[model samples]
Target chain A: MTPLISLLFALAGLASLALAMPRHAAQAKLGALWVARAPWLRGCGWAALGFSLLVRLARPDWRTGLIEWIGEAGLAAAIVVVVLMRRPQLLRGLPAVVLLMVPIAALLLR
Target chain B: MKTGFRQSMAWLHAWGGLIFGWLLFAMAATGTASVFKSEISDWMRPEVRMRTDPVDAVAAAIRYLSVAAPASSGWYMDAPDDRLAATIATYDVKDANGADEYRLAALDPVTGRPDAIRDTLGGEFFYRFHFELQLPYPWGRILASAAGMLMLVVLISGIATHRRIFADFFTMRPGKGKRSWLDAHNVLGVLALPFHLMISFTGVLTLITLTLPWAITANYGADTARAFADLDPGYYTRPRAGRPAPLGDLRAMLTDARARFGGDAIGRVTVENPNDAGAVLLVYRNDSNGVGYDGGVAAYDAVTGRLLSAYAEQRPAKSLYNLLYGLHMGRFAPSFSRWLYFLCGLALSATIATGLLLWTIGREKEGGLGNAFVARFTVGATGGLPLAMAGFFLANRILPVTLTGRQDAEVHVFFLVWGLATLFGLLRRPARAWIEIVALTACAWLALPLVSAVTVGLPYDIVGLGFDGVALALGGAFVAAIPPMLRKLRTVPKLRERRT
Candidate 1:
């Protein structure tokens, strides 16, 4: 399976996790409304991220798989940080709900 | 005498980062580009436009060597993969002085004919500059290693000093002068902390022997080469015999090695004593498939094409070292992973740049010649790098294709442009220098696509249109940055006048 979709899933997951944190979440007033649900959002975020890693690990070779996985994760983390800084609300519930489908689709493809 | 841990770390981070940050920025920027070294080389040499399986290319190279340097010691050929269309071959040949020297040739993989490619240092210059800074051996490497050590210290001290590392990862408040620069520095530093730490640590490890050879010297007592050979059997080099004989078909031997290794691709091939009685051929499997420096090496009698010895298994310790080395080099990375490395490298560069900017901004209120000098130097080095690189690409396109010593000329063009930028910085105000150099770099970037289209032909598969796309994108980014900068420049002067 291609790693692009998985990378997007990982980025979306990290964005959700970042937005759920009080510091980042408070940047957007909408984030404060869901601050109480941060724990649940974070858990879902980690699950999606773990699933994204699993997609990379499923490649034919372990060496490429491992390196690509870490690299993808790194890129995803940077993207999440940038997005949170610019528009934290994009990482809130609605977009997080939309992002959930990416990993689900990634899993089916795998 | 009773300084706190955070205070001590702050002192270390500030001073250490200031002293070595410029070199780190240069290394990061050039090293990021070096990740696409082969593609850049292909783009630089428009004459090399053929792509084929390396197996066929290897045959052509062997044939060329048999005729070109038949009486020489040996031959080595780096097989062309998808990225490169030409098989680069080197053979030992006697120069006009009758001294043994290596001659390199780029051959059309399909036709087995040598390509009259222009002499350009190509992307290898950037790769060399990344670590060696184009200085003399050992000294350049040693200086780079020292910078790496200083970088590691800065990173550790940065983490120690930053009390709210994770908490502040999301903080980036722009337009606060020194505060903004510090925010950017901290954010970029924290965002890619793992990547920064891994790269710096592995960079040190990659040259550990060179950095600290005392253990080897103490143990071996002046025979370090022999000691290394004993420790790592794979490092051994075979001596040529003083007898002449024709070499057997290398393709057939490679086929045998491939079959033995379950159809693995050959990464490198070395022909020892091409025309000698005691000749041998060494075939190494591509390391991309595994986290090892070399997958497996097999030795065959060059004349008879019979297997002599093979090293299919690696020691666990060596395997771990190879894996770390491979990670540091990223030679095993696929396209997407390579892009990720490039992006992380840019973040590292940005971190260094922002730290430099912060240093200047923090002292801007107490401005002096020293402050002004640092600011201008930072602007020159940071903005000048991209401009110089664009100038190098432009030089490659504009220079006479067949000019003698053209490769050295291209390097000279690079340094000359960079030196001019330094002078430009000294003469112009720091803000103006930043805007002007960036605008000039944008023009150079914008011209690349047009130049390539005129000279080489458009719709470049040279890096699968990557070179053109990146050129256009960089051009667009710089163009986008200029108008806002100009507006800022206009407003800043008025604000200063009002204050006066």
Candidate 2:
């Protein structure tokens, strides 16, 4: 459950980070909207990634968690790379969908 | 100054990468397979039948060892864990020349008999091949680490050469020939750069003593054993009392060891002088306990099950080394992390493959003999090797169970197929050869589970099923990759492509 949660966080983190770039934003067909939201998107992206790390490290073994966290983060970023190449137009809504997944995940965990 | 530095780094990255790319690709691919070695070993030994408690497995192993080599000096048993359903019993018995001859057999958890089991190296083959390249000692280690050092050099230079990592992190422009290859090399290198750095750096560190034994020589002069003893200080020895006595209870020793490790899993047990009065049982913690692999070692009196000496390395530098080594090995990783390690390893391999292809593609217009040689070899290294690995699996299922030197034969089949594939690559057009060989390998890999199911029954355990799953996944990936590859190749001039 935690892995899934953290992976979603990672997905959302990377998605927003990609969206923060005007080039990617324009490719997603939301240039003006992403241009206005760039700073917030960037902050959320870094913050989510950081939070995901913390969630991973919250396990009993920090070192194993840390390594797993790094690997999973890379995995999430790779998935984003694949998505960007395969269907660049989907980038407009992926971040929003993945971000909403976090709170829903929290509720499910509760 | 900056451009010059960048050019030098790029040159280093390209040339050095080519020199070691094949070896590194083999190592990385095999190492990824090695991550699930315990499961592979289990999958290979289908005759084992059942997954019982480790204690039950250990008892069966001990009985088998006692009957097989009662006069042996030592008995080493790798008891079954959750992943490996069978215990491996290895003993050292004296030969006619008074030299110790080591023998190993798998014990069935149900019957503890190895007579019905097939002789094979199982996953140990990949684990060893990665480090030894099947070469004899010292030479293999020296060459492997030399390759490893080159890998580290190339990886570092790759990072330096591609300084725009963030800017192009998500970019991969496929179907653009040289541009596509560079994009592949870049994105793969960037996303998993840290993993590649960690793996190669720690791989060098893992075999540092072999490559650079100056520290050991400086410390102990010529006695490396004494140096090892001093380094760990867990060394305990007792002279064998010539009086014959029964080997004591191992299950209790294991229970005690597990308790000592605070419920950590027990890895293996080594019993020295099992037939003598001064017998000793050493229980080591399983490598799966957390990240750093040292869960500590506890020595117990074989007769009385009394705990004697135990040690866990706590010295900062040694622990750091342990952490790095553990990370490199991934023995500490759970299922998810293990898959991550494997995925990252595959990326590392593909990064090398792309880098190799990029070089050949850049020089395609020249089309010299040297260019042709390098191009075909790259095809052989990237495409032929995986085909060879699938051949290893096919050979495992096809070879007669009773064949003498069957293990060596399986290895031979692997190399023979690899040799043939390389020859085929040399004969055919590079693009055609790549597609056909990869397609054939895909078929071979996809057929693995069916072959196993026919020879043995369908995989009964999760480990066996997992091996099958991965094999099918790899086959599917190969099949899926073909269309895109064909589409990409169609855009290029077929006549100008190298046919080495």
Which candidate number would show the highest TM-score if scored against the true structure? Answer: 2
Task: Kindly list the per-residue Cα lDDT of model 2 for residues B1-500, writing each as its tens digit.
Answer: 23688899989988998888888888888988898888877777777667787767777787787888888888888878877877887788888999997777778876778878888788888998999998988898788899989998998888889877888878777667678789988988889888999998999889987888899998899999888777676555687999998877878888888888888777787888887889988888788876777638899888887888998878888888888888899888888899999899999988988888899889988989999999988777678888899999888888999998787899999999988988898888898888898899889899999999999878876777888998999999899979977876785665546542
- Clash pairs detected, candidate 2: none
Clashing pairs in 1: none
| CA lDDT of every candidate | 0.79, 0.84
Residue-pair clashes per candidate? 0, 0
- Identify the runs in model 1 with alpha carbons over 4 angstroms from their true place: A54-63, A93-97, A103-110, B70-74, B91-104, B460-464
- CAPRI-style docking class of model 1 based on DockQ: medium
What is model 1's DockQ versus the real complex?
0.52
| Candidate 2 deviant stretches above 4 angstroms | A107-110, B1-3, B93-100, B238-243, B303-306, B488-500
Judging by lDDT against the true structure, name the best candidate. Answer: 2
Tens digits of per-residue lDDT, candidate 1, B253-312, equal: 888877776887777788877788778888877766655675488889888888888776
